[model samples]
Target: MQTQKIDFAAVQQAFLAAGFDLVGVTDCSPLTGARLARWLARGYAADMEWIGRSFRSRVDPRRLLPGCRSIVVAAAAYEPGRPPTDSSPGKYAVIASYALGPDYHRILRRRCREAVTQLQRTSGQPQKFRIAVDSGPVLEQEIAVRVGLGVIGRNSLLLTPSFGSYVLLAEVLMDTWVKTPEQKPPSRHICLDCRKCVQACPTHALTEEGLVDSRRCISYLTIEHRGPIPEPLRPLLGTHVFGCDICQEVCPANRVRSAPRAPFLPGSPAESRYPSFQELLRMSPEEFKEKFRGTPVARTGYQRFMRNVCVAAGNSGDRSLKPLLESLLSRRGDDPLIREHAEWALEILG
Candidate 1:
């Protein structure tokens, strides 16, 4: 006996049941690889060499999974709570909303897997599918746009009409075709004349020309860059210890949305939500893992996180951090990344 055909309504229901905030589908089509090639050629991707190497796979989902016919795109809303404030005795560190909880890579993967399973079981024959999260070279935002999720804001993030720019994206590539949903106008194609995200970037990473120089992006420096942040951009980092949200924070489309009541995101422990610079500076490698194991903070590990904490301390302008910064500076350590940032913090404080 042949199995029943997969129902689009059932697949959509499965995604929603799996905690996805929005879901859309599109047939596989060629993406704008030439534009991406131009971006990479300009070195806008910074030190992320994988982007250049994986350009073909990123632009064409076919490179990721052979015989892929359709893509199911999902978006999970992450709450962008109040911005981090430095009104405390010392500096209060800022982490992006996406990194506050358990890493969404795992969450999205597991959920997408279950979603695919839910989908396959209903199909006429066994189905083949592959999961793609942020780490995947697939052009998720572009897929999201094609699938009618949202537009890409000036910050280079997907801005959903309901969730703003605070949504995490995931995709499932299937060997079989699914009915395509009606797509909204591409975000970049329909972007208004307003340049709020461009203007709000502290380091001018987001340019008036709608280009992002990732080397100067605070989020990239804090999380991805392993070396010492350049001295010139240190002050521009502000108190953001993990990731920067300035561009999204200033977006007008993000303001008028009816925010998700309970964001489809898990919450972090209270301590991790608002960590102290002194405590972070004192944390050992093991302790750092213990505190941030499943979250995105672990991606930076102890050395880089502490390195960022030192920068935040210096930028805090709070003389109280002097003793702690001194301790890091005076310690017998050859890790110049940490020591140099500590020295810069001291210089800033003095």
Candidate 2:
């Protein structure tokens, strides 16, 4: 089996034209998972057991695509605009910037497939390839670092010089070895003396060593956790209904003057980004599905979303929400998850 020489220049142009803000190639060397093993061993991954289950495939690309020799990593920048402000504190819910648009998985996967097709045309031969857009077991940030895309920040996010930590990552794995440009190794000391993200986290989820305890992470609790949120963390969650971004919001590295508008994920309207708490509390299952159908928030499902809304309403400190919370408790058929949070909110309001 002869390996084909892929034109690196052609590949870059294809990805750039496909709307990727950054693109680089690196050899498919096996990555060391000692750090990941230790992180999991200490139970930092929380309830995401799949991370441990797919440990081997994450550290080695060949495990995902046998005979893989090279990887093309690409990044798309999204605007990390300021969190919406309202005169009324508890009137609206806060959402992470990433989930305010169309799902990245579908967008990146389509763009990656397009680039692969362009590369096949340029090379004049069909190449075996696999596309990963955050769903696959591949460790995207590690590959991005090797490709000179960015350094992992103290918040445990990839912070690129151009877009800071607001870029989405995707990768294309190929069987044929490609010529990659010579580049300096990524620096590990980018965040020296920086503890803004660690200190700013309301839940103290980050460590000085750049590892995150997902169990204490607000984002994980709001979006991933299925059961009732712990009593102590409820007030700390504030009004964040879907995900939290306090860590990224306070990172010095993320203070870019401007970010490239994500071509795939168009800017959502203000109503969508900071939805009214009253509307969300009264939203039916069908309304929830219709409102968040294509966005990442839909992944939480109606039940958990209601649970988050109840928590947010409880923490709002607004007495106006007391009536809605009472209504939720009145429904005997309502999920206990929702009822529990609603009852907690009512007590707080009293």
Candidate 3:
């Protein structure tokens, strides 16, 4: 007689039991395989080429964690108790909603680990198990989409019906061959005829098809890319000093959704929602690091981050900022990219 199979429901139940608002599982094969190939073929990932490089491990969860037979996808809502109000003018340092609270990677990974532990308690330990929260070689959104957690938005964000795009994607790869639930497909989005995102992008980064050209993406220039930001793009960057949500901001889908206070996220800002640019320009690297230690702004580093601050200052034309911009204008940064941007900011302010 064959040994009895462990219940897949027990594993699914474990994640929900452990506080994951969303959880679903999928067989470790083809659907994931094909999507990975498609994303790589388009070459839309830009400098994040690593995404394409880790193809096999991303598709075959078992390659990364041997004996893995089932993959679990989980999401946690973080809709912000109250999102940033409409106006925080003068080059505000707007952070992406996902980064405001404690790092979601840590939060989600711990939750996934807990769920795995609970699964182990009930489903029995096996050869191996692992969890990835945008931390490793998994195609998170693609997996989420294939696993039936959410629909892939034209913007490339995973949009869940109940939560919209405010949820973070996280996953678990386990050794046992647990059964998976068929994922419900995402609903048709309202972005059908509206080209709001493409039309609204200051730099035209959002291609007509919704694929963002990273070189033109303000968020990529200010946050992801190293060295100075491109000059022509400076003025168009607007006031966003860290991450930008312009596309989401203009998106009708994002406008009237009923998500939670985004409790999984930080509460409303005590004093202010968006960070003031002038304060950022003057902050020492050490000071900046401490302030945003794990926050999204910290990802940009000191010098590059300040370069953005300076640009925002120049654009504000507050007159009070002349002394500050003058200070940055004097010191030539080591990187031409940074210097090129500073020079452009001065031109804009002039």
Candidate 4:
């Protein structure tokens, strides 16, 4: 036990030397409290039934792995620093900044594994270590905040002062014990009745007291929803093709001082803060692959992405592109989801 405490502290210092901007460790006991239930009661998670599974494990990292003692929280920002390109109607669509580089799952998972290797070497105690990034049976944001990495914002995202919630979080859970850092809980909740995120949300996702309704959320509709996007939320989608950033864009936190938390964040400037729609519709498969080869958008496949493009194009209401929208619409005999949105776009355009 004593050896574990000493090794844990040393491993933490190593994490810093290894280039991690944020790290924290805490006991992995399951939280038996109202917060967990409240989070679920609000139904902010949407169709992500997986989030509802392994009920006991999601709240407690220790429950995630047998004999787990401590959890090491880690987060790396992925802001890519480029603004969205302006709208070009149906010919183009704007992808989120985080998707401009290598997939975060790969990036964060590798870094987490490396941290564990360093821990195992220096601590001289070999044990089970699992890495989780939006995976694992643990609640990342809740546990991250509990461990003093950051405070939860009204948007229900973990908001670090420097990274402004544009970060990917992961955890290294192992049976090896560590000297958990002593941190004063956050002094204040950063969001102060800041309705910017709530008001700016293209869809009414944010609700009372940090609750988010993922059903109406653009991120959910675009990526998680396999069927047709409800007509009510389509017009609210704005020009975002892959993910929506309107809420984050309007946050006062994003406007504050922020340096890139990860080394590879700088990139060629985006065409505009909002990419033109025309440029998106005209993006060839080759060009799309070249530009976003290792990006998160690759998971959705080209067909779904182009389908989103058509929907965004029709939303632009530029009657001049009616012919173009018609041409794209003609190609969609197999995908009812794409066809349905395209048809709705035509109505909005006319």
Candidate 5:
């Protein structure tokens, strides 16, 4: 029987139809698993032990789905906007642009599944496939580079000429192989000359080798790192309560002219831009859930989030919020971390 050929154009259309902004295909191959294992062994992954635990599966796509042959990599661009940084020392907070919307995991999974369904039916290929966004043990950036999508930037983010690093990457592993377009070798170190991202890191979290030390990354500190932020790093966090975007903002490559609206962040930009310190300090767990429901902010929960708020309050130099911070410090049953940070904020205000 003559084998029917896969039309790559049709596949591209399928992905675009499903709303993916960027798409590419590559052979399923072993990524830098050994290097990742070494990094994990060195404890660079910080408290994210899950990355080490899933090391084997993340390195080899075949382990994820037996007989996996080709990887269909996709990128969904998130709109880039400068987070409001208040130099006025007022009560303001900054949040990562990605988290200012619905969780990318849910959005990308739904969108990728829709695209995969279209690919199967339209291309007349085997339906055996697996979808993964950030949740899965997949080296999405590596796959993306293999497929000629982009190169790893100095900030350790996949950088595309068109989208820069403001994209959420996802992948679909399939059992069937498809002929992908030829491309030049990926420029892994795209920012060799430019060190803006490195210089912009307030905490020097980025290394000279272009890797992130999550221990000092404000994004990691504010979001992933639980408990009272180390006193030394508290002032460095500035007014960022959730995540930091200073590195991206300083990257010349990220100065893209414009971008289409990110589908996940549906509300008015102001609505999710920055949470006021007063509001966050007083927000109950249920209130936090209701206000940030389906958004990444909810993942931090009230206590940890308030912990971040206290740090931002301390950095804000906004004496007006002292009463609110004082209330939190006196409130019984408050997490000690929150109380500790509140006390620090009081000291800063004084």
Candidate 6:
């Protein structure tokens, strides 16, 4: 049986029409899992043990899809028009730009599927494909770099010529072998000696070039960590109630941003970017669901979200939040995680 020829040009157009800003293709060569294995051995993944669990599949594309031959990497730029204001005492909390809108996982996955369907129609053959939108074990950034889409910066993010490091990546692994154009190797000087991202991290999570200690990363603490935040790190969290963006905000590569062709999701309200700490403190579980149902913030769940709000409130040094902290302490049914952080915040305010 002859394999149908894949039109690479048509493939690019299909993905671009599906809302991706950048597209590239590469062969499915197995990646050395050494770096990832070493990082995990050093416990850099913190409590997110799933990364280590999916080790084999993550390093080999064939493990994910039997007979995988080529990979289609796509990127969507989400850089905001303006940088978010620095969080301060008694002010609106800072949220990572990526999480401000509707969830990218669903948006990118649907778009990837659409692109695959279009490819099937254009080629007149059924193509076996799997879509991975940050949810799969596939090494997306590595694959993106291999396809000439971008280089990994010192901050460990894909820095594209047009979008810098402020883009979301997705992959379409297919059985159809697509020939990719030969590409010049990306320069190693993308980051140079600039350590702005490292210096800007309040928690010093960027311990070395392109390496992060997840235990100290604010993003990990706020979203992934499921227990009491270490007391010392609590103060460093400042007014951030969700994921942190300090590293990306300070990177020089992100300064000259390109306007995204269109937002991946509908424009989120201003409230999502600059949420009031007071309102978050008083947010009921039902309110939390209604407000963040389809957004990344919803993944934190009510208890953890409120726990983050408490830490931010405490850091704000805003005595006006005293009553709310007291109320949390008064409730017998309040989650201990929330109460512990609330108590710490009350102490900070006092």
Best candidate according to lDDT: 2
Model 4 per-residue lDDT tens digits across residues 1-350: 35456454676676655556778888877766355567677786676777667667776666668878888887776554464344344344566776666787887888777777776686665478788888677778777777777887777778887788777787888787776657659637879867788877768898757777889887777776667777777777766678777677777887764665456444725763345666655566676677667778788776677767777777766777666666666765456766676677777788
Q: In candidate 3, residue 342 scores what lDDT? A: 65
Runs in model 2 lying further than 4 Å from the true structure: 85-88
For model 2, residues 270-290, the per-residue Cα lDDT tens digits are 666678888888788899999
lDDT of 5 by residue, 58-143 (tens): 98899999988778888888775444445345546777888887888888888878877877777767458898988799988777
Note the Cα lDDT for every prediction shown.
Answer: 0.77, 0.84, 0.69, 0.71, 0.79, 0.83
lDDT of 6 by residue, 1-350 (tens): 87766867888899999999999988788987766777798889998899999998999999999989888999998865343365444577777778977899999999888888998887864367888988899988878877788887777788888888889999989998786678657646578788898989899888564878899999989999999999889888888888887788888888897878768644544566778877777777899999898999999998998888889898887899899878766862356887788888888999
Stretches of candidate 4 off by over 4 Å are 1-3, 7-9, 32-36, 84-92, 266-268, 272-276, 282-291
Clashing pairs in 3: 79-262, 228-337, 228-338
lDDT of 1 at 193: 87
CA-only RMSD, every prediction: 2.7, 1.7, 3.0, 2.7, 2.3, 1.8
Candidate 1 Cα misplacement greater than 4 A, ranges:
1-5, 83-90, 124-126, 182-184, 187-191, 259-271, 330-332
Candidate 6 displacement at residue 332 in angstroms: 6.2
The segments of candidate 3 whose C-alpha lies over 4 angstroms from its true place after superposition are 1-8, 32-43, 80-88, 258-262, 270-273, 328-340
| Candidate 6 off by > 4 Å | 81-90, 265-270
Candidate 1 per-residue C-alpha lDDT over 1-350 given as tens digits, one digit per residue, 9 for 90 to 100? 43334556777887887878888887778788654676677888888998888887888888888988878888887766553344463457777777887788998898888777776666633267788888888888778877677776667777787878877888888887665546666645435788878877889998665567889999899999988898899998887889877788788777766654336446543455557777876777788899888988898987888888888888877888888777776662577788788888888999
Q: Write the per-residue lDDT of candidate 3 for residues 24-134, one digit (tens) a residue.
A: 777677344564565456765657787777887776676888766777888877664344465546646556656666777777778888887876676575447788887
Which is superior by lDDT, 3 or 6?
A: 6
What is the descending TM-score order?
A: 2, 6, 5, 1, 4, 3
Error of 3 at 29 (Å): 0.5
Q: Against the true structure, what is each candidate's TM-score?
A: 0.91, 0.95, 0.87, 0.89, 0.92, 0.95
Better of 1 and 3 by lDDT: 1
